[model samples]
Target: MDQFTNFTRKVSANLTPFAEKVGTNFSQLRQIATEKMSNSAIITELPREYVETENRFEPVKHIHADLVRLARKYALDEGNVDFNKLQNQFIEITSSIGEKITNLASQNPQQQNTQNQTQNAYKPLNVTIQHQLASACISNSEIVGASLYKFGSTYEKIGDFRVKMNHDILENCINLLQGEFTSNIELAQKSRKDVQGARLALDALKSSLKGASSSKQAATAIEIEKAEEVFIIAVQDSMKHMKFVLGSPIIIESLRNFAAAQLEYFKESQSLLETLVTELEEIKLTQDALYYSEVDHH
Candidate 1:
């Protein structure tokens, strides 16, 4: 009985910090998103903030810049939607995870990590066509040749071609984020339900420990120890969920997608530009040959 008491207290201690951290993580993320949502959209348009308009229309680190411009403007400002119907996505996802943490604190531990099959897991609800391209898989890959550098030739087109390539990449990234936003929000809802089920099982052990007798208490403690082991397995999952609450995975994926999109443009532009230079070289050779033949005849 004494052993059970000590073990129960230990489990309680572990759960307290986990529960509190879960709350803090969710609140921190939701707060950051709320604070930045409106201003970020405006900042994305400003020169050199999220995008550079002069030399190259390149995006800066602010990946969610377009969401600031398009979603907030159309959905919140002009669309006339209510808060309940259209809550901010980050806030919504955090809220969903927060509820899961609350339920899990009382419930049984899970046998498997849900993070293995979370929203972006499995087949990927948001498929990135760019990631399929070679450039996306291989970052910063480019082709160079001596013919590309000839005076007033293919080298001149490089600057404009790169800019256009980046433009397409940024555009695709923006669209991808927009699409995944809703899907993740929905996943949060579903994850909450799955966690709730785990919570239900977890509650049984807690109840067993609540008013256990000398005989039953030992069994109860053992059951708790079993549940604790599960919690231990799922702790890594919790941390992943915490990061998901903070919107890191989506942002990281977007950056990768940008690189992938750029790769495609690099390949296609090199092909077309190299072909043009080759044709130009052939035409120059023909002209020289004709001139030399006329000179010989004279």
Candidate 2:
């Protein structure tokens, strides 16, 4: 873990300062640093964790759902917006996000308890799918960024390296995505077991809480309380397995780099779009001036 952390620190030390010099905002880069750099397993496990575990889940789910709804609202609020393009992009991005959420929610204790053996058997597959999803998200960001770069740069030879870099990043993401898809099938088989185990633990805790509240039986309450505590600890341990597999700092660092690169691409893209809009406005003004001038001369 220390070695991984050092590697991440070193990678950041090298890339971030240079990226800032090249014009990347250091602060608006949280998504890159936390989400991208964290192990793919952590990213995969987080959405699941926040969704599955009742004690730690409700607030997180509410926040996530709200974010999703807000994003949809923004897309729809534009009355003049191109509905097809806007909605399609929104759906693709959001749906992928939703899938991640689903995976998290599926980790109920009831499901996990029923499939313990199967879950243990399919660890490898789960790992693969998770890596794929994490890699794809990064790669997709690069692809979008590269397209923007190409459009923004007007295909100039000087921007060739940037374009090529984008392609390389895209390729890397694609490979990871493919691996994830392959692993996803195996992971599914164990999903039930994972969720069931978690649910059972939560159920036990709930029953204990009720016993403490209803009966004046201190001993029974203590026993239930201890059971609940034990259950929570067990759940935490299980989640760690899923989380650490991907939460490795090395993966996190790589994701950070990918995110940083994409942000650059996005900024460049926005600039290009603005330039195009400005040029069109100028052309319209020039045409209007020519028409008025000719009429006056006549």
Q: Could you tell me every candidate's TM-score relative to the true structure? A: 0.27, 0.26
* Worst ten in a row by lDDT for model 1: 42-51
C-alpha lDDT values of all predictions: 0.45, 0.43
Separately for all candidates shown, the number of backbone clashes (residues 3 or more apart, or on different chains) is 8, 25
Of the candidates shown, which would achieve the greatest TM-score relative to the real structure?
1
lDDT of 2: 0.43
Model 1 CA deviation exceeding 4 Å by range: 1-63, 66-172, 180-247, 295-298
Model 1 lDDT per residue over 96-206, tens place: 545544654665433112421252243221111222232222221222222222322233233334334444443455555757554554454454444333333344456
lDDT of 1 at 24: 43
Q: Top model by lDDT, which number?
A: 1
